[model samples]
Target: MKKITIGICSIGSGVGQSVVDSCKFFREKVSLIGLGNNPLAYGAFDCDKYAIIPSYYDDQYIIEIEKIIKKHEIQILIPGHDDEALLLAKNHEKLTNIGVKVLSSPYELVLICRHKSTYAENFHEAANYFVKTYKAIDIKDEFFPLIAKPEQGFASKGIEIITTRDDLEKIEFEPGYIYQEIAVPRGQDPSYNAFIKQLRKGNNLQVSEISLQLLFDRNSDLVEHCATYNTLKGGVPIEIQPYTTTELSGFIKAITSSLKRLKAFGPINIQGRITDHGFKAFEINPRFTGITGLRAKLGFNEVEFCIFTLIYSIKIKKLKLSNKYLGIRQVASKKVLQSRVISIKKEDSVQKNILLTGSTGMIGSYLLKQLSDQGHSVSRLYTQEKELIDNKKGYSITDLKSGKINLSNFDTIVHLGFARPNSTDSEIHSSIVNSFELATQAAQSAVDQFIFISSQSVYGFTSNGKFTEDCKTNPQNNYARAKVTVEDHIKSITKLSNETRFTVLRLASVIAPFDSNLSHEAYSSMIVSLLKNKTITLSTPNRLISKIDFHDAVDAIDHFTNYSSSSVYEVVNIAPNKNFSLLETMKTVAQELGKTEDMILTESIENEEPNNLVISAEKAEQQYDWKSKTSLNKTAKYFKKHLGY
Candidate 1:
């Protein structure tokens, strides 16, 4: 069977959410389209497709609804609010002409139900069950302890309880107010009396209430009815149970007969409280109520029955009701990360907001300074509590993972934090997991560009010649394996996002001997040995190594931050134009430090195969128009100047 396309309006309201929830059961038989005035409506997020339209009171509301219905090819439209229901009922012919069926009662019936005075005057069959109501202008002093309600309102808004003459005199007589007798008599029920006594003592308590839901077919024949006794907390039903008594059954039978006489169709909800005078209805809603979805849990779904009978022309003989469980309502929450609205600006706009992780580390520290010097707004991310650097505030990684941090304000995120090779197994594991989590959050938050500082060690120590970014990874150590894991995870997670661009930079060994913040084992070991001992030994002196200047690595990252492309995921190797042997690199450093060649010695270990590490940066050069400019000799000179040897 072809799925019915149904559209629901006013999705920001409680009834709208309930209708959406009820429709979920027949998802295979229908396609749902949610329409809301607010952008963050919960029901909007739950639908297959949704659109924001004008308010029901707006002049363009009907036109917008028509457009949306035609766009989505909607065959049925359900009104979610009383006012919306009345408006749609008034334009029944206009909507029907466009091949759409509106699930609503007649306009006259809706208007009578909306106005309390009108309902009391027209609903003669249920006169004994309805509380005596009067116009606000005709209320007298004898009508003390009466409840004043808005003539046209739902959800119990604008209700005032006038218990004394003084209370009545002090209230302003609004134009659209109706006065009705309170359902609970002054001293009749002990439960109501006790509740009143506690309320007088400044303690609020829940009120016992009941609701009778009636469903009718297109021909005004009563199809099903459900009676529920519930408790209200702050005008909302918190606990409810299927309830029926000898007296209540009689009341329902009379009301159903009266509604059928009046040609009532679709869903109708009557709300009241049981008093000594019997069940007194204070209000009647001519459409679905907020508990409609809750009713589905008991297998008495009025929505499904109405759709099948009215829209599909299929008769529903009976509804299967469940009394095995009670329905409890609680507060539920959903997190919605709206897409960031970026202002239109020139391409060369300065002052980009950047978030930097591992801000105190070697590459991060240098990158932070460079970005700040370029007039970019930079925020540092710290794993633990630390002192402020340059009076800049630090954000916690915990906050990012927990969604406490709003990443929409940032244009770029540079993640350089990682555990060193010497770290414990647990620490390394934590770092790897945190890195993936950060990437996932970044993608979900819709950050513009996410640059992950990966290591070329992911290629391992097996390649003897130069390798490009397309080479397969062969990790030889736990650290290299962790880097590959992060790379793969970032690519997979970011592929789902259209707003975030993920760039993975696999950097070669970075040489920054002049900076004390450097802690990598390879460069640190070589420098420490050359400075402390007159003779330095190398096991694999001829082993080739690919290294990039610290400034060049930082520059490469800056290049990608400003780069834009159609590709959402990218991986680029960052290395120098030339590769050198370990012996040649140490010799250059010794020469720069004014040491003779005799100070450096080479030794070969027996039965050991030489392994070389080399990577090509042709992708970065071709795509980013960038290359490593600083040579090894220039880096060595900086070391000599700092060491004063």
Candidate 2:
């Protein structure tokens, strides 16, 4: 594959280090050239090849940048700061002609986004139903302590509140600025006049965005995080504050309908004032505000979203993250806030918002039994409809691209369809994406839990001895990658307190009475070879194979009821204890089936020092009150009836 060249630019202050770092994590073999002085000092850039240019207006800006770009034949340029983005937008076409790509929208769009005054003015006119009147009050108005900000410029640069004429004189008066009426509070609490804004442009309200900006007469200081101490009095700077669950669905639905009309090109932050009439629009931040960072974690990733929109004009619903799923974010802080806690107010019902793939598969069929037994209603996605019985069960292999859903009126989606290595790549990708896409669509149905049946294919071999859920994974092939993709998407979308859970059962090689790998089901392969006096090779001498019976797998699925919000159970190796050798395993089955040794060939492939996995299911047992009760030998007895040995 050809190497992708990149130029990284940060604005003057408080660059988007996190966004840049995240980009760097995915883009390898990137020729990363930096634009800005002291960028290295911030310790954000860690590219394979890099150079630094001075300030945006510095003489060396063109000289140094061009040199690095030409040297590396740079193709894509991603800005880390708003100011750098502004400059690049103006010269966007010029850069494009010079074989450089600016990942931003047009100049006019950039202006519309950057100008804070324009947002307030435009929203004042546009926000008739959702927002109240937005007036650009005079900077020198008689209004005591007016909230004021420059119409344009970067993040938190020239923001202040005007309490007196003296405070106004300290700041320079500029055109296209807003002097808004400050919200007064009756109580002494800081969040007394707390407000949440839902930007409504002609009725299409996409989201009810709430930002808690601190007020000190004359836009004192822009605190990045905590908007206020007594957040009830003012507003909390927390991203996507947990709204009352009762009002959430209706509120979000209203916002979604409102924003569909106001087609916008860039980031928009609307100030909401719920007056005597209704939600009155106060101000609008035209550009991608810091709130973009907050809302993105709700699974939207707006930074990523804007990049695509700016380049391709594609409007992506930020990857549909949920606050309903349990989320615990631990940040290093000197101020010790109260420790995080998850206390569910309402009792979560079983099988609400359910999407269960492999609904027809062996383990899936068994899981269906337990789910039904527990009074949980489930929706299934089956691979094939073989018999008359499947008709009543809603057998479906729906088309994912067209979004033709089978049964998405579900609350929990249990995905079990994954293409194996024997299947082609497209087939594998299709099955994985289909399973997830089905679940993703089901999550749209207010589903709370997304349970996927993933194999322990991720742990190709556990060499550092025994493995736990926390052990690092080293997937050797496509199967592990597919499972990881689904898991990642689930976590990103599932929110805290949605009662939405993402549980993966990283089962061991499961063998039932019907499995192809069953010790008895396909013994003919080794039996024929043994009858021909062929030497049987066993490479994993003195090594262990993690094993699980079908019943044990079903038990694990039943255990998701008491799922933890904090723990992301990625790999629940649903394996039984005791790793028997190929010879020992065959013998165990043979004695039960009353088969002779002549029917089996114990191939010893010699000591390759095989790497095997044995996971600690301590958490599963402790938290879910679950334990594997069936032994491999006992389960193998079912082969007597099913397998024609």
Candidate 3:
């Protein structure tokens, strides 16, 4: 089984602990990364690996989380507390950009559940079994012996019994404070009279409250519900049993159906008491209950079910219930090692706003997708008048030479649109004019940097063994000359404008899927032909080529864009160090596709083959600490699945 990293925030909380405990059962398949604001949170130590993060209210909270997600490559992030859950749900778009799946209720539903007053106002009828609830300000002619608690209070915190109107008057009525009619608990059906007698005599003050744990999917459809007869100790469920009554179960099902309209997801806990009249609900917690671990140990595992269903798209079979299933909770402690306390500080990193050109081009398109996935705000610049559909936010510059493009909102302008083949002298001049104009506009505007994508062709054909960034440029063709001209233009802009920095990246041949604007490359072409059951014929079998994967190309751009440097200008070469000959690459692709080397027609191959040019990225690695990490084995496997080879 493939292992995936899963992060649980506020893991010290009850809900987070439950999730961590459940993840332990799937240790073979899941790597749990626990996070908490407090060092004392037990879940932090209980998880496979733990870290102490700032509170959700902290300004650096999301930034730290993004760093952790990137470092650990966390695929799913589960918020354990109500506030964190709501926060994660609110910033779903931001987190999902990094491929992190957040399982949480909708923001609206979270609001309804976080405050008792809101839940009572919006869902009173559907939850009629609940205690008679009223806002403190709206408690007009209500009877005495009312229960008052904070509207957004968790557990039994901030609860007070109001026996007289004078008592209510003496207490300040804050917006978050609400009043409710108390419903005395009654015993089970057969022992109801005896329990009431004992309660009246003060001999027994037991409040028989049962907690109903409900599970829902992303679509807000209820998957299952478990009824636990809870024995509370200081507002915490201590002893629990899988107990259910027909009347109580019916009421819970109705409530679940009503909540489904809110698109509420994950586990929801409904706490209520059994009274002489009937089962009366007190409040609803739109999250995993405190008894989740106990319940999982007994029969059902909601965390596992939810993860499997949501992440893997696997359907879970209905869990078999057992009334005899029982579990107990006790105070358990683990001696903490003082050295394990990890203190986290905010790193010095700023968010970037990128203006990317040639978004419709092959490389640019991939770069745009990758940037967006990494939570960077990138705006696409188009030269033609294209309708912006699917809510793509960008600007269209019909005339780039006019210099009407807006560079005010962007911090970096990346130019990848200058390369145009089969153009006349006039068209070439127009492209050059447009490229220079755009660079000038960027340098003059508030933009901090201008990144020009140049080609390694600027080096011409290197006579030496390898070409480095320090090598003098010797343009051999129109395309190479055009790239060099743009590079020089950008350098001149940097000299004139002291505020803006300039960077030039001379990229080698990239091995990636060719889009409509891109030409078929040797690597991808060989793979595609193999998938189509076609043979490849090469006149020269020993033509060497140095190629970088498309992903690594994106990595190079990301590194420089995010690199905070004091230098005014820098030029770097970007390419893989490994080199492969045409025949060797063809045989590898064929082997990966389970085809024989005979599939490649090498009969016409000449004994002598041309040597390939080489470029080194040592400057990029030393200056920006950037290196391309691509394996031919992995790339081949990716192409097999990506192109159905």
Candidate 4:
């Protein structure tokens, strides 16, 4: 269990107040801290204590929140309002350090979604295919006794019940708010299934049993009212009208298909009201809330997934449901990191069993998780699997050399042993070459479709627009040359009627969460400099490079093994399309750390005359439907809080 620090930023508002009540979930799962002046909040939850911040816009909000994050040793901040959600996304990794995982989208998405008018336009464009709508707000007249809300407001803050134009005037008529057509009263509509069906069908995804409770403080006494499913006798109270599981599956798939383009990797809350025929969605939340935890308890754990990915560096392949109905009651956990390796995870009989080499390396470890999550029986190639019989992950290389390893039991193989194609040192190259030689032998025995993790540097230094799989190989360095040698060797073996096919994945420099990787260390160095108010020097002056998040890179290897095994005998590059010069990347690192950009100097590195290199993944996408999702900006921030610059 991971202990979390969750600060409710605007407890004065109803949504903020619910957060305090939500501490029932946060009691131990997350430490609840209030950041507003209102004691009138917390309609249902309780907390150990609350810290009243000056204001939401106060510059000191970040300063004080940072303090609470450190004090509680928290790993996640579950904001109560939309504003805080925006703030969380912008400062995810910043808050991520000091044990804070803020629930929000990537800042880029937030910027595009925060403005209602703009979002309405873009949402139509982005989701128009599934929704087939011209503009969401324009459809308000089609259905009424409807609700109207601020495009970016939260907790019914600027929400209005529009019986007429006069009611809209009560909320001061904001430009960002949009009047949405409401669902027909619980017994009157059927078309709602169109949207609900799309959302329930997805890979490892669980659609929420949406429940909307509206509170009215009429006169003095507060009353709770449920409208969506209030008319149903035994159905769960819901905002989205309930549909049969079979029907909603298609709905979930359609929506996610649209969201896939957005590259969503966090919690997304949709507010729906049950209509007479089905359900109507009123709003979309790109962050976590107590409701998400409710859905988690029922079947989906989006809350856990959110913290797992953004803060703990856990890559979520798909939503896992715990049918135990063991409700996810939030309790601040004590452990910051926890590992659960499925020793005997069984996949569906339909999915093929795949083989992965270098089963103990960091990249390999992650790749196994990817395959296992994708409904594949992932058996590790451990030299000591026979000795431990039960355990396949932690093994000894000595055992492998003793001829104890066997590989004749799987469908695909991922050769992911670490190889240094960029090392300037000859000894390191020889050692890396040795690892590859040994790994290939292990793979060749059992792998039907073998994939090797080769580095992008093997393409050689060049100024081509980008290096594709077809890029000319000019391995000037020993490391690159050695890789080229092995790729050629493997091709020859495959062509000679070997049962096993092979793929060589040329990977970009990967940025892992830890500073152990050079890219992260470089970024960390800049953050440290910014915090210490020191200047740093660099040498890779003008070299343009592409990078992959370590997890994403590993996932690409998995994709090759499972999906692209048929498209074999080809080399592929695993890298983001965006390329940044070494100096430019370092400066961006500085800017993200809230530092003066001038602190990092390109002049000191300009003399190095670095080579320009970027790799394209068109071939990989064409063959495996695989592409990198962790963008440059997101990768840079993973280490931002570590140095706290």
Candidate 5:
């Protein structure tokens, strides 16, 4: 099936975001193009393609939209703001002429709905339920404790409550402002009074605010309607539940009649309170509301129904709604990085001054050589005076501990120094102390970035499912515990500083061909057993393990050090996409060395199941575009050549 291309305007507004959320339900059938005046609009990152266009008030707004429509071959355009909707409604002919359907009401009806006083006057069937509106100049003492609002606004902006004549005299009256009786009268109902009192005290409590949505077909006949009792904070619904009342049913019928009289079609939203006299409507929006997405989750998907009915001419007979669950809302964020204009053709394309610890360690030695060869200025941090004698750019660990090293001189810090897995308690404690001090100083100096190399053992090596970065840490040993402690400390110290970015790369077991300086303990031991004994044995042959190539580990460090643009703070796993069991790995080694499978042996335990230590590198791929390129079979070949097998 061909996907329908849809365009959304005012992508930063709540309504625009709601429409974007609704489109996800039909993602396989539709393509979204987000349009906004600001490039940094939140919806820009959510859509398939985004374009910055002129504001709705601009003369070139329609022309720009038309160009985008022709370029992307858009079939439908949905307006996200009230003012923008009205503008689109006025230019409905221009859009429809270009083979695009504008999802909005007629221009005449939108005008009445956009203006507060006009809406109140035109909806005569619900006239008795409309809040009494008074002009600022015509206000009297009897209208005390009235709510003043802008004649044209959304999200409760420019609104105030006037409790006394003195309060009214203190402010200047604007031309486009209207005063109305408070929707909820004081002392009317205990629950309503309590809600208002808490609101006055600025408490975040769930209070009732009823909203109704009416869907109309192409013929301007109301076909379906639903209502939600909502609780709002900062003009956004935080919680919603299905609600119905005798007064609400009558109000919906009356408003349906009013909408038919005014020839309003498509989606219309009505908001008000259940007051002493019944349901009084204070606001009417001619387009979808923020809760439209929430309604879709509850199975009352008006957006889908309207599109099928208006565009495809499909008739939807029954309105299905599920009220068994409550809807809750929370804020979500997405990071947008500035695009890089310069192509990184070589490792030296973008140079950064780096301060590196653990210069003699397995991964650190390779990383140090790579950084220096790439033309980056590298300064090594040594734990002993003897290690610093030959290098002029080297500083002792005492220099770091005593504040003798000026950390601000370096743009980035990579800490890979740690005690070995079998180290004593005191040695591990000392190592942790040094790392904490370094992180504290780095944050204090406002370094641009800090990269810490941790281990996958922090996940506790469970036997079950694969572990993503979000899995809870269950450090089972001293080494894993120390890593978690240091990770927490680094995150805490860097939390308040926006200038410093801290990244924790939880690395899996590293494997490579045998080399005195480069070989890791596990890989070296395996190679030695295979060469000397001409056979290998495993107690738990089915145990799954995660390993990365040595060169790939070095590349990951380099990528995060310079190329990652928007990672303020993150913790991601560094592992290969493939998984291999202990027995399979040994067999691959034997095959590379011209040995048969009979040379491999396993002692299976009676009831012991094999444990898994598989790590997920999905976040690294998605966030930094980093992945392992070297295969395990290739590493086995390298081992064959290194050992002369």
Candidate 6:
């Protein structure tokens, strides 16, 4: 059977992530793609593959998404945010023509459900149950100690309680602001004191808050209603338990039935309180609530059933409730980084399933060895899963041109591989940029850290005395330009994840064993001249050069892997403190090879180039407590042995 590809936007949001998680119910039959603005968003990492798009508000947002859909062949495109849902719904026709279904309610109904005030006016059955709503101008007959919130807001933003006439005086009433009678908590409840405390913290005070999620068919007929007793923190449900109330359920059906003409096609959430009179629904969201994951664990799994039914064109089945009452409680976590090398808390650290890319390259080979020597459980991400010794641990790009790839089950992502596109112009952007973006998408997953091996070439050809992390980048060549692109992309992705750290090390040219493919200019010249007894010409023998041994590069990586700090992002220049002139460097290598005068050098010419193009490693030395331990002489000797000189 052909895979049914589904793509979801805002995948980092709790609501969006729940939708992605639901696809796991279908296993291999479902190929999930996550799209979002932030690279560090947890949802970006959770999907089978993902792409980055502009912010939903950006004009290009839909355009970019449309491109992703056509490229990935996505059959269904699900928007996870309320505003995004509206955006997609508004563009449903255009997208549908391209063979993509916007898995959301009709645009008209989405408008009705999005604006809270509109829902009450349209559904009279639940109007009386709604708290009396009034604009500031309608305050003539309204009472004090009322609640005020955005008329069309989601997630309880801009909510305030007016306890006195004086409090009301301070508010500059806006058109979208709605005022209503405050819902007080019941004194009889066991947690009444806690509720009062929470209310004092400026939260909406209510005796009982409930979430009624109703799934509607494409024709707008109600298919299923799942209710949950909710405990909220920061407007997000932290604890939830399945509940059944006949009166509330019937009332919800009546409310939704009134909107038959809306023709909503997916999930609708009603958030309100049960009061002395009856059930009062103050707000309604036209999309999945943030507690969707909690509800799934309790057996509803609306996201799964909804997507499955829509994709298969099957009739919606009555939801089966768990025989035993199910409940879920969420815990929060925070990340902290510090100066100097520090051990990560065992509980906080992802010490298992470390993911490594660029394993086939020079530094990657040594890194693999170092990780193994330290007894780490490591996995390799390969371009081809078949090339991996353990295919289960590998991640592969579905399509490079489209930047589609699934990423999961890793603690950290070390990105070292880069596409060396031969083209030095815009023509190479697609392939080169796609590699970085795909890696970023992979890092957005649950990985705690993303380490990218950047190059000092990003600084281009700086004529300054020395460079630092603060140096302004002026990319000169296509390779350097690509590196800068990756750096910026990585920064954007990691910004979304406060708990994850992104480290970019701008390394000096590396001196490694002679391999035409991997060796830098200086190392290659030294090896070729010594082995073939050929002359090594220099424009100016007095010109100074700074190079790091391959081993030092490995050591620097080890420092980063072990160092823990409070910062979520850091960039450091990796270079030796000392510099070597061309003549001195050539003599050192020749002496190490015991070649002496056998390795010839052409006469030097007058040149105006600076003696040094090195960067300062002060920050690396102070913060990471590490620096180059090998001298240029030692590097030459090590290379001589490795090169079989």
TM per candidate comes to: 0.53, 0.46, 0.51, 0.41, 0.53, 0.53
Model 3 stretches astray by more than 4 angstroms: 137-142, 187-208, 336-339, 343-645
In candidate 1, stretches whose alpha carbon ends up further than 4 angstroms from where it belongs are: 136-142, 185-191, 198-206, 315-318, 340-645
lDDT of 2 by residue, 128-189 (tens): 43321134443444554565566553333455655667766655456555555544332432
**Would you list the C-alpha lDDT of every candidate in the order shown?**
0.77, 0.50, 0.72, 0.53, 0.78, 0.69
Worst 10 residues of 5 by lDDT: 336-345
Q: For residues 349-405, what per-residue lDDT tens digits would candidate 6 score against the true structure? A: 334456677676678878987876776776666654454645454555444324444
lDDT of 3 at 631: 70
Candidate 2 weakest ten by summed lDDT: 333-342
TM-score of 6: 0.53
Model 5 clashing residue pairs (backbone): none
What is residue 235's positional error in candidate 1, in angstroms? 1.2
True-structure lDDT of candidate 3 = 0.72
The residue pairs that clash in candidate 6, if any, are: 39-493, 40-493, 45-445, 48-406, 49-405, 337-565, 337-566, 338-565, 338-566
lDDT, ranked from best to worst: 5, 1, 3, 6, 4, 2
> What is the TM-score of candidate 2?
0.46
lDDT over C-alpha atoms for residue 422 of model 2 = 58
User: How many residue pairs clash in all the candidates, one count each?
Assistant: 0, 57, 2, 39, 0, 9
RMSD, each candidate, Å?
A: 13.7, 18.6, 23.0, 22.7, 11.4, 18.0
Cα lDDT over the full model 4: 0.53
